[model samples]
Target: NATAKAELGRATWKLLHTMASRYPVIPTQDERAAMKQWIFLLSRLYPCGECAEHFQQMLKEHPPQTSSRAALSDWSCSVHNIVNARLGKKEFDCRTLSDVYKCGC
Candidate 1:
């Protein structure tokens, strides 16, 4: 139902953002390609059909920034803000991203 979809979206975004927060500072070419591929695969495999469609379109428009950890994290926050705006949700404060998303893993 709607609650399940919303929960899925929350979990997905948390995972993505946390991954970005932990990404290599200066990723290797292969690492960069892997992150890009992972995002595309996620868009295709996401459970919610409508959300997946919107995510694919956003990916097409913004693409992923895998050059560095900071770049990837910033890109993630920006894209998430876009989605939040679309959903009438409050935008996250990107300045505190690093503090907010420590994986401790």
Candidate 2:
């Protein structure tokens, strides 16, 4: 079960980061709103209940930063780092996100 959860988490993070990497450089207002709404829905619908609750709280505190692709990617990295810290894992270098999460799009 733990292995499954970990795999799910990794897949989810990959999806999130890839989406952020491919986000519009200058998204329209409606696009930004949609991105934020999608994030909220993700928090609500994540497979792991405990992880979903934690993500919801993080959203309450940090909210989604959808101003630009970079902002959303950086916000996601920061939030991922927060979870890493909680898990006693090493934090990722946020500056290298573009290099790390190339969506090839």
Candidate 3:
């Protein structure tokens, strides 16, 4: 039981980490405000409809930070969401998400 739980945790962490890494650090208010478009892109990573289509266009126009701490949390959150779907685990707590994505925030 402990081993299974540990593997699950590791897998979950990896997924969230990968996703979060897609964001940027935007150190200024202007930079932060400018991210509205990208933030929207992140929120609709899947379910390839107009939202996804639009997001893809934006990504091509301006690729993500790729290694930003600020982005890690967001990417991680998305990955976490997918992992939950696969594992049938409940979503991580908001506090947990906040902490995992501290660098991104």
Go through the candidates in order and give each one's C-alpha lDDT.
Answer: 0.95, 0.95, 0.52
lDDT of 1 by residue, 6-84 (tens): 8998899899999999999999999999999999999999999999999999999999999999999999999999999
- Taking the tens digit of each residue's C-alpha lDDT, what string does model 2 give over 1-105? 899999999999999999999999999999999999999999999999999999999999998999999899999999999999999999899988988898775
As a whole number from 0 to 100, the lDDT of residue 44 in candidate 3 is 71
TM-score preference between candidates 1 and 3, better one: 1
Which window of ten consecutive residues has the lowest lDDT sum in model 1?
A: 96-105
lDDT sort, best first? 1, 2, 3
Report RMSD (Å) for each prediction in the order shown. 0.6, 0.7, 9.9
Clashing pairs in 1: none
TM for candidate 2 is 0.97
Model 3 stretches with alpha carbons more than 4 Å out: 1-5, 8-67, 94-96, 100-105
